[model samples]
Target: MLRVASVLSFFAGLVAVTIWIATALVEHAVERDASRRSLEWAEFAVWHVPRIDDLAQGLPSDPAELAAFEDLAHFGGVFRFKIFSPDGVLRFVSDDPGSVGSSLGTHNEHAVAVLTSGEAMTFVKDGREKPDRPDLYSETYLPVYDGDRLVAIAETYMDQTTKVAAVRTEYAIVGAALAGMILLALLIPSGSLWVMFRRLRRTNAELEEAQVRAQASDKSKSEFISTVSHELRTPLTSIKGALAMLESGKFAELDGSAKRLLEMALKNAEVLHLLVDDLLDFGKLATGGLEIRPCATDIAGLVQDEVDRIDSYDADRQVECRYTGERGPLFAHADPARIAQVVRNLLSNALKFSPVGGKVFVSVRERCGAIRVEVKDFGCGIPPCDQERIFEKFTQIDSSNTRQHSGAGLGLAISKEIVEAHDGRIGVTSAPGRGSAFYIDLPFCEGAAEAGAVELRNVA
Candidate 1:
């Protein structure tokens, strides 16, 4: 949630910044063009003022001259020309002659600037006090040169306020347009993210509901299995006892065919007993009822004892144990019986996958403040994709229906749980057909480092 909010805020901020930047650029461009035009008008007025003043100078200072000047003022109305004497008094006005003798106040700084420099000056005013006037005004003043002597100052006021006002309006429009664009950009992705979040929430709700249903179904299945297995156990026991009696010739001496059939029956009964044991183990694991009774046991001795037992059961096969690093009686803080169970499971799995002549190697070492146990086998290794999932509950590599392997595929899963409970990790490394190595690493507690040792053991 925090991550999503951060992303949204970042995008919104980007939109705002982009809009501001674009508006600023447009304003700058508009201002530049307006300033250029203002300067152009100032130059034009300054150059043409001298000719107007010369015609007025030739006429007498009479009513005729006043009327002619008034007529000229009307002709130059576009410039709003006002002629002022050397003493800064208005002599002619284009907008109104009523103020002909009026003072052309200090606002005509442009007139003073032109008279003193014998050049032209332009001034701009943006309307602030006059609501009826334009927002911007440009005025130019030129010294009306009479022969070699300076005469009156000719001033022209141009309403360039329109350009600036237009620019401002354009700026507002562009700002609005950019703001709209930014809003659109933000909305597109934001809406998409909102939809995605909503969909994800809905999917999570469905998944949770499905999980609840699956859990209920699993509970029912486990209960049914437990009840059925319990009820079948008594009947199976009685049947096995009756079969034993028949096999022992208690009822009658069996012929050769009968003897063979009885033997097959006994083998099947044993198989059923093994299946029951596996089911019981699974139940115990499920209920968290698997008990461990620990004692002061020698790790190396226990491992060798189990190896001897397996070897004794199949004397035709060979099993070897090698010791590396330090070799001595080792002790650890663990339920030795549970630890032995993990070891047996690994050994049994290796033997099942290994050929008659294949080797299974077991090694224990102390490294990096931990005890490491490695079981390597030169047998058919698991596929790359299957290696990780192999330890999941009830999962097996050879999943075909006709596969000859026997036993519930819960050994590795149980082994993993046991190792993790002991504060250890179990992992495997394998390459297709190159065989595999399974490793168990456990942190060594104080004074419990020497946990196990591998010794050369004979095949019983």
Candidate 2:
């Protein structure tokens, strides 16, 4: 508001200054032309009037001379005319006979200016003080020269009220136009800015509403997952227990195709249980309920344990598993169970993607004051574009319906959540065909640093 007021004030000042200058120039020109015309008339009277030299000798009694003086007084809007001798005596008065033969003072300013400069002099006088006249008058004085000899001075007074009115009217019209243009220049952009401000306010309101709705939808989805996971886990637990009993020969003896069918049922039930657990974990993570219990633990031992477990479980695949890194213990502040889960997930992915007889390598070491673990596999690697989003919930590299892989695709996502809860980071480096290497980095515990047992080593 202050800025707008300042702009208006500046524009008004500019207009006022422009009008003042223009009016001054026009008035000067008008006054100059008036002075020139008045002087011309004075010169004409001096040329045609009979013998002003005789008037200095005495008052003119000739009727023709007196008539000429009267005609000069009334001509061309002239109000009064007077003739002065070189010695400052008023020789003749055209309108006022009473002032004839009066001796003006030697210091009469107008007479002295005309005689010395030989130039016309003009001035204005207000007649408002007189009872009989109420108008402005312009007076001019010029010296009459009879062939390089100063003879007398002629003075004329002319009414100028009409010309003054015309100049004032012209100034008013031009000033109004310039003021209108300045107002228009300021108003147009101010109007556009006001409209844009309103639109921005409306857009901000819509965005706030959309954000509220999105948050509500996300809460509803998390509740639904939590409820469904709890319901499925109860039945899945019973089915898994029954399958375990049958596989253990506690319910019946199984052989041949019957034994194979029992094993398949047990495997599928376990997979279902794992899926239910994944769903529950996802819900807990979304609701900020997933937490880590950190303790000092040997990272190398954890990796070795997960590798041994995977080897025993997937013995039929005949895949090679190797652990090579720091021979000494690498300890970090982390949740042991959660760290184990993360390692297992990485190892499981490596095995799943590897060909039968392909190698899976697990390594653990200290790097940059932190414990680092890497699980690498010689398998079909991930595309560069897909690597970034591979750890998101339910995202699978091979997502086609007929793809040669199976699972709920929540392992990597769950692992990422658990690792982050322990203040660690997990990522993968891969290409189309070379292979994939998944790594975890965790901060070292104070105890591990004090123990002075941590060392950096290269993985074979």
Candidate 3:
């Protein structure tokens, strides 16, 4: 509705300005024409009157001279006449014999202007001011020059065409012509603009529908992944348990080849299990089904335990893991199991990147009412450009198939989701070839950082 009003206002204002300008032009042209006509009439009067050069200096006393003016006055459309001496004393008034001998005095400015400039002057006035000619009329003062020496000025009133009628006629004709041209000017662009506006609206509507369809497709994809991952997990767990039994219990005496084949199968199965777990977690995060339950969890203990678990799980790895942190329980407001999962992911990443005998360090600290746990490794460092991208889902800095490390690339993204659910922040600081440090900062549980490990145990 507001758009419609704005569009209407714009066009209305355009039309108003155009009419105003057109009327102004018409008025100017009419005034110029009137002045030209008045001057022409004055020149005609001087030429027709007999001996006008001699008689124009004063009122004509000779019978022949008076009769010449009387005959000229009788010519059609003549309203009145005034003959002015060089000093602006009125020598004659054709309409009023009483005004003939008076001085024009202050009103003689128009006469003086004509005398000094040796040019014609003309203007329109109401006729009610004159008794004999009570209608609309114009007055003109044309210079009567006798070969360059000014003789007198011929002041005459002509009442042939009223100014109001000319204005009305001019306005009608000019208004119609200009209105047609302006309408044509407006119609051409308005049609094009209308077409473009409709096309833009159609394009916007199509884009909106495409967006709705895309959202529905993404939701379906997450649901399918969640269902498939859940179904694969149970069987995968069963296979891992059976493989462990076969390798340890009675199949321990198997031949060398069989043992080697069994180890490879077990390793591949574990890898498949980890992939399925990551997929399931990713689906939950995407669907907004992932949640955290907060409590006073010992952040230092959580880091140490996960580090040990990763080292034991990957015994073939030739990397040394070191931990330097608060000796006692350093509590943070977090869910223990979820935070442990985050620690495991960070530790596993650190160990995978560490070269032979290279050390990975884990530390915990409390500062600014928050508990921060950090994992550092002296491995091939991340570039500044890829630091933030590493935390995105399914992303790897070395994405080629021949890259040494392999995973679903959902670990750090999942860790980010989990930490944020507890109102925590995670980030990394590193330089190329200088290794990397990844840290998670979580709010400290109230009074929990100050409480002793013994006190925590008693509370539990």
Candidate whose lDDT is highest: 2
State the weakest 10-residue window (summed lDDT) of model 2.
451-460
- The TM-score between candidate 3 and the true structure equals 0.71
- lDDT string, candidate 1, 358-414, tens digits: 677776666686666777877788888998898887887887899767666877887
Query: Taking the candidates one at a time, how many backbone clashes does each contain?
Result: 1, 0, 0
lDDT of each: 0.65, 0.79, 0.78
| Worst lDDT 10-window in candidate 3 | 97-106
Writing each residue's lDDT as its tens digit, candidate 3 over 159-201 gives 7345556776778787889788988998999999999999999
Candidates sorted by TM-score, descending order?
3, 2, 1
Model 1 ranges off by over 4 Å? 1-48, 51-208, 218-298, 312-327, 354-361, 376-385, 428-437, 449-460
Cα lDDT over the full model 2 = 0.79
Cα lDDT tens digits, model 2, 365-452, are: 8889788899999899999999979999889878899999788788899999888877889999998888899999999776775564
Which ranges in model 3 have alpha carbons more than 4 Å from their true place? Answer: 37-67, 70-199, 241-270, 294-301, 324-336, 364-373, 382-388, 398-401, 419-434, 441-460
Q: What is the lDDT of residue 32 in candidate 1?
A: 52
- The TM-score of candidate 1 is 0.61
Question: In model 1, which residue pairs have backbone atoms overlapping below 3 Å?
Answer: 136-161
Global lDDT of model 1: 0.65
**Distance from true position, residue 230, model 2, in Å?**
1.0
What is the lDDT for 8 in model 1? 100
